[model samples]
Target: MAASGDGISKSDQLDSSPSSPSPASDCAFSSSQSSYMSNAPDPRPDIPSPLENGSMKHHVNGDSGVNGINGQMKATKVGSRSWVGIYESFLMKNASQIASVESTLQHLTYLFPAKFKDAEIASEVVYSALGILGLYHDTILARALSSCPSSAKYQPSLHTRYTRHFTTRNSAYRTIAYMLVVIQKTELLNEIMSRRHGGQRGQHTAILGIESIKATCRLALLRISGTRTLVTPPIPERDIDPNVLDQDGPITHAEAAEEDGDYWMMPRTGQKMPQLKGETDVTRFLMKKVLLPDDVAPSPKLIRPLTTADGRIKEILYILRPLVYALLALLAARLRASKRFKGHYEKVVINWMPWVVGFALEYVCRDGIIDSLSAEGGIRAALTKITGLEKRELEKRSNSMWWWTLRGQFYDSITKPILDKMIKKAENIPLLNLVGLYITDYQYLAETYHFSTSTL
Candidate 1:
């Protein structure tokens, strides 16, 4: 917030000053110089002429303009740093909620074990999601470990279980989310490259063009045709030639010295393929399942609409987004209510109530006929806890399993089918087509509903 050393911030100056002068203003002579040459009366004798005095140094050689730009750049850097700090702090503060969401999501991944065809594939999906989210790495692990409670309820075994689940799921959910984002980015890259090249393909434009996408599809097929594991040639240790290195020092190997740049390089029988930018092994695995090219017909065996494992996994996460938000909101409410924190009641209600309501609505939709039965069971439990007279009797008589059975049936018969249909429908639309529709819809809605009614 400090001044830009020109007496005021560039932002303040821009706001306070008039619009910049027209180009014609550069051709005009100084009024004072013109008056002096014409022998006209001095407009103000008391005023020091800018040409004689150094007070107008700001105007000399466009130094003011340069200073303004520099100030703006500095302000931008400061703003970026502040924004990053705020985002990191937000992530840290919500680590527990994030951990819970991830744990639940991983458990949900188990629900679709059949969808993945095997336990290993389902586990792969889970791990892929984790890797994408950076949870597989130490990035979120430290935060999660620090935020967990060190109370009696969280015994060593319980803590270990919690940490294990947190690490596994947090990364998995993040991975799935990141893959969706990457799909959009890659699609955009493809479009831009195609527009620039107008169909004629070259190596540089290949990644962003149709050729790259076709190459990816072909690569995916080659991968699917073989076992998932890559077979590398075994390196045999041999006595190094003393002449290989003249001095007793570490030496770079010839193979290590070659920096591979072409990501689209096809895998040869005994050679390794160059790694794709912004991709992990897990990410690459998932992308191979669904990445389709504009020119090629999508393979029936590959992921289509909602039929493929990747599509189903992504869709499941999409449907669960509301639950994630609900969990976060509830966690935030607990944080706000804790003795250490202070916040407005209005804010708590404003931020928390909608999530609570949405969660309730979703629960009702999911449970259908079972919602009332579950509510009844919850109320009965609460009453028994308060009375304490028939706690043992109530526990013995509780029909929780009956309610759960009904809920399960509702999910299997109604909710799951509807979600499956929706996922399938989504698959019919190309990824790029979906993105374009979303952007167009967003723009239309913003223009129609915005206070300014901006057409842009």
Candidate 2:
């Protein structure tokens, strides 16, 4: 921004005029060539000696200095271009990896969702959000991580804002959520809020109210037009036998449970060892605790009946079950950023409650995850990923599950506190202290940016 004594700014230093180099360029050239005169060169008969001809010496020195300056300028230009190219290449690679991870997670949710968690729908809209003129995912991510320490530039991104927009909620909820997450860093969302509602907190309250109603109406329409209870095909347990990963031939599956026994996962023996259940170590314990297997590891049934009731029973509660839960989910999704809640208790509740409720609903219906290998990724998924068409249906089916993690409350509340204590203890250790620093940065990133916090 500002430059010292000579008054040439950073921009001028990088792109100075050819005839007049900046002070930095001049100083660099001087220091680099300071040894030039002392270095010995082979004597040439045609060259005039400085001692014999003073004017000839000045002429040669002046020409040599001009040529060197011109060369330095040319090299700087080339280097700048090269640097930009490298930066872009790395950015695209990161985006691709992000998309891939999101896709995998979404499918995994459908196939092997957390004990209580429902399968994630097509939620890969992130990759599509890229290519925006001034927006970059990494830049937004950096801002999010930095904001956790202070909410000075932060805004509670509520789901109500975009839920009314059918195409967007279906496609770009994550991107839109992400855009809101980094509202302060990139002024686009800020400008939008200001333009629409006079930029006042009070002014926007009415919009939220209106949006809440619209969202309720939309969900009502979906419920009325849809089935009374959520139903899906049962999910299988194991994808393939781990022992088969070491083999070189096609594996066999039980003919009776062909669809339930296998999945589309690659069998790689590299960098992996069998997970022994006998180990008492923390790592093994954590690996077991992190994932819980499905309740019924039953053989695949061709036609599973999810509903058991034969009809009748005109009960109010039963009739309103979908609406009540759907509304509660909307409320949870919209309430956090309202500033009315004094604590993040609601956040933790939203993160896990719907999941628990989902486990029950699916349990009663006898339906689990519906299988689909091909699904289009959403904007979040693409930036975060890209899923399949049927994949979108999975996300739709995931409705009513507490997706409170969208704002990343669990990481900040539960994971952060634990990791913070661990990092502090690690801070005093030898090699562990170095690892602490990396984890600390990553912790902040995960806290700030909830894009990777998938609904799956």
Q: Which one wins on TM-score? A: 2
Clashes of each: 6, 24
Q: Summing lDDT over every window of 10 consecutive residues in candidate 2, give the lowest-scoring window.
A: 293-302
Candidate 1: RMSD to truth: 31.3
Cα lDDT, model 1, residue 229? 11
How would you encode candidate 2's per-residue C-alpha lDDT over 1-456 as one tens digit per residue?
A: 222322221111111122322232222122223223234232344544444655445665566755664466545544545554445434333432444454455444322212232211111122222323223533323222222222121211111111222222333433433333233222222223343456334324433443344334333433432222211211111122222211222322321124454323346833322333334443533433331111111111111222223211111133333334444544655566575655668666765554345344433322121211012342344222212222343455446244433323454566678888999999889999977776664454344332223221
Candidate 2 global CA lDDT score: 0.34
Q: What are the candidates' C-alpha RMSDs? A: 31.3, 23.7
Model 1 per-residue lDDT at 413: 50
Worst 10 residues of 1 by lDDT: 228-237
lDDT of 1 by residue, 1-456 (tens): 121221221111211213333232111221212223345343345654444666556676856755665466555544545554444445444433554566577666534423334443444346446534533223433322223221111112211222233224455433433333344223333333343456433322332233233324323322332211101100111111212211222332321233534333445655535444344543633333332221122112111122234323332332343344334534544555664544577555644453455344433332221222234466454343221112321232233223221122233355446645655567567885554444443333222211111100
Candidate 1's TM-score: 0.18
